[model samples]
Target: MPALSPTMEEGNIVKWLKKEGDTVNVGDALCEIETDKAVVTMESSDEGILAKILVEEGSKNVRLGSLIGLLVEEGQDWKQVEIPADVGVPSSVASPTPAPTPAAPSVSAPPKLQHQPGKLQVRLSPAARNILETHGLDPSNVTPTGPRGIFTKEDALKLLQEKQKGKPSELKPVVSPAPAAVPSPSQATAVTSYSRPAIPPISTPGQPAAVGTFTEIPASNIRRVIAKRLTESKTTIPHAYAAADCAIDAVLKLRKELAKDDIKVSVNDFIIKATAVTLKQMPDVNVTWDGEACRRLQSIDISIAVATDRGLITPIIKDAAAKGIKEIAASAKALAKKARDGKLLPEEYQGGSFSISNLGMFGISGFTAVINPPQACILAVGRARPELRVVEDEEGNEKLEQHQLMTVTLSSDGRVVDDELASKFLETLKANIENPMRLALN
Candidate 1:
């Protein structure tokens, strides 16, 4: 399989657009491959005939550089294409061997041990082994469900859930005794009033319906990577945070003025521009944490976090400091659309120097975001709301006035950006946001 992204070690074949014996041309989309970050379409780079497909659809964890299919010249006999014996078959497609039947034990023979110390009798898939090891679960406790008495990830997960639910006594529901006779009309009315309808069990497509108190939604490849990376970031990095409330009245007025001319922009667009300008003024905050040293980035590529059905992905706006407000707005809009549609290429979503996460549209007033690693800082933006504050009038009298204010919190890595640097970055950001005209000028 082709490596669709830098961190992609394996991929899932979502579907193959081209089947065997089909004519393939350069730039033709061959299949949709699920990478660690997104579901990306793998396009053909050469003209040929798709002779045979070794990997089937819905196959997951196919290693990089593994032969997935055979291609041949257009004029060649595609039917006679021979499979290479040296090609390693993916585990997903390999046929499982039937487990051997054990011989009957002799009357005098000692009982055979199902499990022995330092060795497990059950076979396990790599994913199943990893899950068991991570949770400190004994392989013997989990029943093998795969062919040839092999344990799978699903088995490991079910065992973990069973363990988490505690013992049988704790799991048993309390049973109420039945009434000796039917209730009267008044009593039945009261019971109906207090009774709640049973909720239907939730289930995902292609998965079995839940038969218990909870439903299990399998984690996608993207979500698994996100979990691993976020966990590492939280454990390994020392994070510091600083927040500032900026008056966005000027920005609102500018947006309205632009709307009249058919030039539309959003609050987030202005935030991106302001952040880029602030980073330009204070370049220290634009650096990333490199092992053995701190590497300052020469360009300001801001990654904007976009939520997708699969997971959250950050698509970068390259050279944001050099782009105008309109340019930034346009880029953000297009990138967000691509992210939601899962059409972003690796370069479009990788290697950003900084990141901005805005939950303002979701009605979040204020929240701190985790820093995207390698990059030193991430700015979390909250929704702008009208607030009453005491202001000095021209005549020097204090009066309460309503102003649009937004809360922005900066999360920085202490290894690269200390508390002092984080505060300065937020201060500069607040200044730029309060006076949005400076952002346009810059």
Candidate 2:
């Protein structure tokens, strides 16, 4: 899978672009991978005669670079390639020779997802929509803060509030109501007036009552797991947050230059890149508290957070610091596509040296994220905004200037990451982002 994302030790096949008997050439898209950050697609880096598939659709996660399937050179008999015993996929999914093959594809496939596109469905309240329209805002750009992606009035109201207060969204709000039971229309049986509680003539008011029936959809295995882990993370992680204002002028300048080709890259991409570099610089931050010992790692594979229909998922952007900007963009795209498709295996979503959650594109300026433990640090990014700064003129007169400012938060495990390490990492990340060319130069 080209180690599409950092946390992706493996990826689950949401769907196979090439089926059994399907011919796959070098650079052909094999499948979309759900990495921690987004759904990115993987290509056949090598020319292959696609001998087998490891896991089928709806399968849990799989390891990256593991034989999710094979890409054999042309004219080679697939059966001749001995399959490893550790390739956990069923033989049927792995070797499809004995299985009935599907019809050959009608056309040659195009390159897989260059970058996974995010779905922005906002169900805004009518009032919120009006405010957004009044501000010449496009709700499409603001992620919905409602159920199943329905933007609510509160979301728009809050967004507007932030804009007016000389602030952007500094806090990534998890506006979850008290865990109410599933919404169900009540089936009621009416009671007669005679059965109602009696009242004096002067006090006479309401009478009858009714009882209703409902069926509830309990929390799924995923939801339950989320509840347990998040709660545990909060309860035990001993998290301490240190936030810093970051200058994104250089990064923004580069992004605008890059977007000219209609090749859109979000600010979060730099956030991802910065987080990866920071992890590399402070390898101690790339560790997990194993309850007994602090386990620091040599390699930094940071998982980027992507929200999915199922819930919050963190797909990895593996070895992010090493990849070029174009490659990072491409990998992020493919990872996102696979994530939404729910094809992620356990490995794709789990294991990370660090986590980066960004709400900057959504106009958020700062926020603290809960600890994603065993990993010592989780970085949160807020939106970029114009800030007034005093600068000296050539005449030595003070002048006010506007700068694009962003806030980056590093939530670290109190047990290991001291304030000095966290602060230095944040500063370096800020410097790198502000001078994004450093990344290119390096």
Candidate 3:
């Protein structure tokens, strides 16, 4: 499978787009693959009738070039070929999975000739070498640290990880010092924080910046995928951004009313409902563009981009416009928990009709987002802040107005959504957020 992002080591098939016995044209979507970075539809490379599906759905940690299934040209014979799991694999491409009952390894015949050996050296796989290269290490430079005279994949990876140590590996221009002149125990008393850094903390109390030496971590599979896709979108697709200020006073009041007694709904939950109602009001905003054709989606499965330890993940609230605030909140919580635990199956993150990304919690004031592929648009919700302006009073007296204003930026693929359509969609969203009661009917 072609990598959607650099950090992807494997992708799990979410759903087979074309069922067995289905004819597939070149470039037809064969299945949906969930990589570390995102869930994407993987297309077939060859035109043929799908002969077999080897990998089961919901399988985890699948690798590239591993047999997903068989695709033979139409009219091929139906019998006698044993499609071994190891077929099409180079001897060098290490198997990601091991058989439960592994056969006895081939016996190495004892050397008839005399042998003289000191250190056992091993060979590292190309994949291992790539990992090393990514860490700015040369294979020839490091001594093999594995057992036997071979450099196994695990050994190479372990060595690389040790070298990285959560920090970007920097090749020393030259060895700074020899292994000498070490300090004594008394001279090496442990000290934690430096005195000067505690003087002024940033306004956000809990958020802390790095002090002293710091490490820049390598992106995980999901993050790498996000980067690549976003880069591709920004470079390949022309994007036009439209934003409108949404008054959240009504929304805040509605959420408080909903939260009375046993019922509880957050501001975010309110936003989710408002967005769904707005999406239904302007159907074009819920559409995905497939280059030549724009597919209008029937359901509003709104995917909320959630933060996780491994990377940013999005979990959908299916038919969100029809769900109550409590249900959405529960779904959001469950999905977030699953995502954080890395227990989300591929299907859990797939099939989002539209997406919403909020930076409100982080106090960000309006930023454009990269559109997820096949998706027509994404809404970037900003934080609410107090704003003041002059207004005509009911008695005709000029008055200074104080209000809660939040900015919502809608980024759409120019190829599908024209400027006028995008504007109207934004207006609808603004109205929904401003008139919170209208969203409650859902």
Using TM-score as the measure, the top candidate is 1
* TM-score for candidate 1: 0.79
Give the poorly placed runs of model 1, Cα more than 4 Å off: 95-151, 155-213
What TM-score would every model get versus the actual structure? 0.79, 0.53, 0.58
lDDT of 3 by residue, 114-219 (tens): 1224322225656555555455444443444432233445555565555546533423123345675566787667634355443221122244564543333545
Candidate 3 error regions (>4 Å)? 1-218
RMSD of each: 9.9, 20.8, 14.3
lDDT of 1: 0.84
Per-residue lDDT of candidate 1, residues 1-442 (tens digit): 9888889888899999999999999999999999999999999999999999989999877888778888899999999998777876665555554444443444553322234454445667887777665555665644476644678878866765665657442121335678667889878766644455654433444666667546656678899999998998899889888899999999999999999999989999999999999999999989999766799999999999999999999999999989988889899999999999999988999899999999998999999998888899999999999999999999999999999999999989999888888888888899999898888678
Which candidate gets the maximum lDDT versus the true structure?
A: 1
The local distance difference test score of model 3 is 0.72
Report the C-alpha displacement of residue 302, candidate 2, in angstroms.
Answer: 1.2
User: Is candidate 2 or 3 superior in TM-score?
Assistant: 3
What candidate 2 gets wrong by more than 4 Å, as runs, is 1-216, 261-263
Pick the winner on TM-score between candidates 1 and 3.
1
- Top-down TM-score ranking: 1, 3, 2
